[model samples]
Target: MAASVDSPTPAASLNQEESTTGSTPFLRNGTVMSRSVKISSIPDPSLGTDERVGESDRAKRMKEDSLLLLRGFDSIAQNLSQLSSNLGSALQGARYLAEPPTLREIFHSRIENSESRQEEVEKEKIEGGKNTGLKRKFDPDERSEDQGNDFLNENEQCLEDKKLKKAKNLAVSMATKAAALARELKSIKSDLCFMQERCALLEEENRRIRDGFGEGTRLEEDDLMRLQMEALLAEKSRLGNENANLKRENQCLHQLVEYHQITTQDLSASYEQVITCLDFSSPTSSMMEEADNEDD
Candidate 1:
């Protein structure tokens, strides 16, 4: 800004000097215009202390306004950075809430399988019980062999005894197979009962975990909502404060405008004096006045 303010002096000086349309003031050793004479040295036809003071004050106020606007931009940037960080943190917590139902389903399925096995065993036991009942009904016929004296022929008696022995062996084999099957069925029932209990416990635990997760989710949402509300309120406050600051700046500008209006009257008087001298002296003075009027 200082460089720009200072750079204009050389151009103004060239305009005042002898008319040389192509006189480009070369800066150091090459291309750019570097050093320039100060504006005070260029002879304006009319000047005063009060106009000088007004110009200086306007420049100072403008510089201060630029500084304030820069600071406001920095504050806005910092707020945006903080908001981004908070959103990132919220995303991480959401990923951890998805695991208990899978374990519960697996446990329940195992329990169902165990119960089905038990049912199959009970069905086999019922079939074996019916066979055992038929064997019991024929048990009395085997006892008739005790009256062996009626058969006096040894061959007939020996053949009858052999047939009885074969029947007895078959009954014993069938009983052994039935007893083994019953024992297996008993074991399977116990295993099913145990699995049912375990699965029930696991399901209860799953419910608790789900409840806990729900509570956590509600808490997080509540916390997030509260945080968001607070952020909104804070933003409102910041905006309000900024608006107040802007209002103050606007007030300052209004006051500055009023001050400039007062100064403009004095400058106008000085300007009228300068115009009188310019009209008698230079042809381009009309153009300069037009340009200056446009700038104003």
Candidate 2:
């Protein structure tokens, strides 16, 4: 009994020494030990025996570890790439906001001008003589009511013509812009989908790498990384929608601008044609009359 106890102690001590050194093999009972619970009956623990390695070499483990380390770095690089892409996209959106759409600017300008014209017309229509008690006593110098009404009619016609042209221009611009926005939205959605697919592929790669590393480890900060990725995905989706909407608006505005420009050109051409056809042959025709009067 004493000898048997001493033998077990030596084996235990050898195991301890090998485990500490790591340079030597750490032993475990092979099939022999699995066959019985009797410790003494077990043969040499050949779990680390050289025979198990056939075509594969032990040095392959070092290469595998190095490869795993490389994969970890690759994952980190991918994460950085994702972060950069997000930042770039946000910056692009900001840039787009700064540029705004040209059609919107033109629309604002046109609306402001219309308001001013309306205010001027209202101020003119308000009878100045009654309010200020500054009654005019002139006959030849002052315009008759009929003449004043005629002038007002001309102004109204001019303003109405301008408003009609502006309306037609605005309608055309809106149509053009809508088409452009639709195209832009489609492009942006395609890019976003591609990014999502890339993200998924990276996640799959990470899972593959983790599996290769064996499951005994609780990866550090994996939860945090996953949460961050989720947040990024959400942000990306939101941005994609916003980009699509903005592009659509931009397209609509672009069309409006083009339509207005076309209408403005057409109106200018018509005005030129009318001016060309106007007869200036009579001495009372202001342009001809001015020359004839100047001669007298």
Candidate 3:
């Protein structure tokens, strides 16, 4: 009885082992399915509040970082657009400087008029002086007065001629200087175009660098791009200052040209007045001679 209680018979033991083996699969399957369902339905208790807080903080940081990147990209885009607009305006200014046909035409016409007027004045003076001197014989005292008046008038005419010549020379010089300035403007335009191309290349290189580095070197890439943008901004400011200076110089040149033109016009008007006075004086002198002949 003690042996039976201590150890089961082999058949009975074998039967019990077979029943346990047969029930183990169902138990394991039910327990595994229950545990899986529990895991799927419930939050993990092992994930602490600290870990959740850390995850939330990390998400917040990522969102903030994305916003910052978007802002930076927007700023960069605005800067690029401004730079392009500046370049375009500069090109337009250069083009205007290069092709000043209207100014050239005005200068040419004025110069031609001055030359023709000068020739007409010279011919008129020579013919009128010869005719007046040969046509009339006056009393000795009257002749002396006439000669003195003629001498004074000739001196005035000579001075006027000299002024006209100076004006013509100045106009010619100004035209030549304008041409030189135009050439310089053309060179500046070319330089600007080269700078634009270089900027484009730099932008392409920056894009390539960004693509190659992806997310790993994001901070380093931002720093590098920031430095590049700063450099570009500095260059743009310098160019803008130079452009402003050029504009000022162009305005000064235009003012000077206008001043010269006014002076030339005034001088021409004065010359016309002198010619009209001479014509009026000639008729008076002939009447005086006729009066003198009647008195004789």
Candidate 4:
């Protein structure tokens, strides 16, 4: 009788130890242990077979649920990282667009450089023509007059054709560059208008925020605006922290609920097995008591 009592005590201790170590593994091991305990303790073969089968199914379902939660967490983390990256890129673009001086200076410098290059090209063409004319005048050709005239006309025609081609190319390049600059200027003007409207909206929002604080504070507009911005940023950070904490708390609560559910199932199964054992032993216990009384 002592050995029978002690056998169950060791199994229960082992179950407690397994439960403390880990959740998923403990659930599986506990279910198996409970089934074994039921089979060993209860003499009736068909009492808890269906109940044990149901418990095993529940354990499998809980395992699948935990896996799904883990997958959800992973997907959420990936989405958060993507959102953070996109936000960072958007901020960088906003900063780039906000600075007017840098963009204006870059475009102005490019226009100036193009103009200077065109001037240099014109000067080089003029210098080359003058040099060729001087060389022609200085040269004393031994060829006949008609031959020399024909050669000079052919050379002049070729130079004229080359100059015309170069001028045509320069005109095309300048026209293209001018069109590009005009488009860029138009875009800049639109951006400036947009920024102006945005600034106006921001000013309106600032006025509304300031009004909400009432007229009790006697501070400069800039100072008050700065303070308001600081307060808003602090509030945003606090809310973010609170949201993160809530998520953590929710996860913990879910885990606790699952643990309690498993514990409750284990307890209920143990209770049913104990009842069965007691029921099966009752007649034998009564018979033993009767025999003892007769012996007495």
Candidate 5:
């Protein structure tokens, strides 16, 4: 009974050492010595391995989403670059379509002269007798029977022929100008239609980009860009119409120049004919006529 009571104390001590060290305490030779030592590490008991793995997976997902967002931003930037380039090109094209500064100055001068000539044309049309202005002022006392009536009639016929030829040339020039203006108008219309289609395509692409991104602010900005594009298209159309009208006005001015040219030639030719007739008259006859007038 004494040995049995003492045996329980050593066994209890062995069990205590095993519980504290997390290993069995082995007996060696005559004394018991620890074969392995356990070093305790600090760890939060609440954060289990499973919970840590879940957090890691969530972090990975967040990283992936961030990367995706970055890519989306990059794509948006590329789209913006393309849009900016397109707008620049469109503006450049518009600039090219506009008249040059030098040409504009020329057009201004032409227009001023055209307006004045138009007034003259209106007067000519209203008078219905352009010959009245062309006819040279002459005195009946200067008339002579010696100047054959046949010669005077012949001069009149020649003048009529020259007038007819000038009229034909002016008509031909007007027809040619009208044809050119028509062609220019057609080209402008075609260009406008092409630009309209291009704008429509851009708008559709913008809508798709907006829908894909699903960003409210970006969508609104795109909408504003679309509105600006529409306004630009409207302005371009207005300018095209204005240009066409200006072309027509220019054509009218060109016709006026032709008319003036023909009229000038006709006046010069008549003046030459009149001077020739005066030169052919006798000087003695003119002196006698002067003496007779003085006696009266």
Candidate 6:
């Protein structure tokens, strides 16, 4: 009776064990599904060949465009630096020119201030003398004074001519420089406008590529690599967990199978014992019948 009672316990345990192990395949299915999702998320080299080509070309074009823009900007910056220096020098020159007392004016004013009236005063003093000899001597002094005045006038005229020439040359050079500067500035402005438009287009293209695009589109190269690494790590962790679960389920199945084997062995031994008793009882009954017959 104890054996009978204990016998159902193993069977019941087996039933519970079977029920528990029956859910493992669902876990395997989940693992398979997760693996398949990972596979599907991977880029297919076969189908994405054209896309890869397009991406390479796009990257190349963008790199070239950016390089060109950078070069243009560098040149523009250099030109601007030079232009600023030139403008500063030009401003100083203009300020100097705009102020009073230019070299020519100073030279002329000094010449005028240095003019001598001493010859005329000496003439007047000599003419006021009563001696005829003094008058005769003063006549040559007047002629000498006139010749000195003519020489001063000639010197002034030469300085004026030289100054006028210098002024004209300076004015011509300044006009040329100003015109060239204006042209250069216009060119810079146009280039800047072109660069601005180019930058706008690049920004728009970048936005189009980044916004709402799949998988790695919105991510930088480093971010995408990091994300892929994280995904791989997560997958590795999940697979480890699944393997652990499988090991646990295998252990449970092994234990259940061991119990079933033990139960089968016990049942077989009991069957053999019952069969021997039946065989012995049959022979004993036959013998008793023979004895009874003989006695009668």
The TM-score leader among the candidates is: 3
CA RMSD for every model?
Answer: 56.9, 29.3, 27.5, 51.3, 25.3, 69.1
Q: Could you give me the TM-score of model 3 versus the true structure?
A: 0.45
TM-score (all chains, Cα) for each model: 0.20, 0.29, 0.45, 0.26, 0.30, 0.26
Q: On a 0 to 100 scale, what is the lDDT of residue 243 in model 5?
A: 79
* Ranked candidates, highest lDDT first: 3, 2, 5, 4, 6, 1
Specify the highest-lDDT model's number.
3
Model 4 lDDT tens row, 149-223 = 757765765655454445444444544555565576578557656755655766687887678668654467658
- Encode model 6's per-residue lDDT on 236-286: one tens digit a residue: 576567557756755655565465445435443434465676645587889
Task: Please write out the lDDT profile of model 1 over residues 35-109, one tens digit for every residue.
Answer: 134444576655667789889999999999999999999999999999988888777666545534443355456
> Candidate 1: where are CA atoms >4 Å away?
1-152, 213-296
Off by over 4 Å in 2: 1-102, 125-165, 168-184, 187-259, 266-296
- Give the alpha-carbon lDDT of every model: 0.59, 0.68, 0.82, 0.67, 0.68, 0.64
lDDT of the structure predicted as candidate 2 = 0.68
Q: How far is 5's C-alpha from truth in model 3 (Å)?
A: 99
Worst 10 residues of 4 by lDDT: 263-272
Worst 10 residues of 3 by lDDT: 134-143
lDDT of 2 by residue, 178-274 (tens): 6576677799778778878877876776676567557554555566556756876786788778877786777757666676667666654545465
Residue 42 lDDT, candidate 5, scale 0-100: 47
- Candidate 5 collision pairs: none
Better of 2 and 4 by TM-score: 2
Worst 10 residues of 5 by lDDT: 29-38
lDDT, candidate 3, at 284? 80
Clashing pairs in 3: none
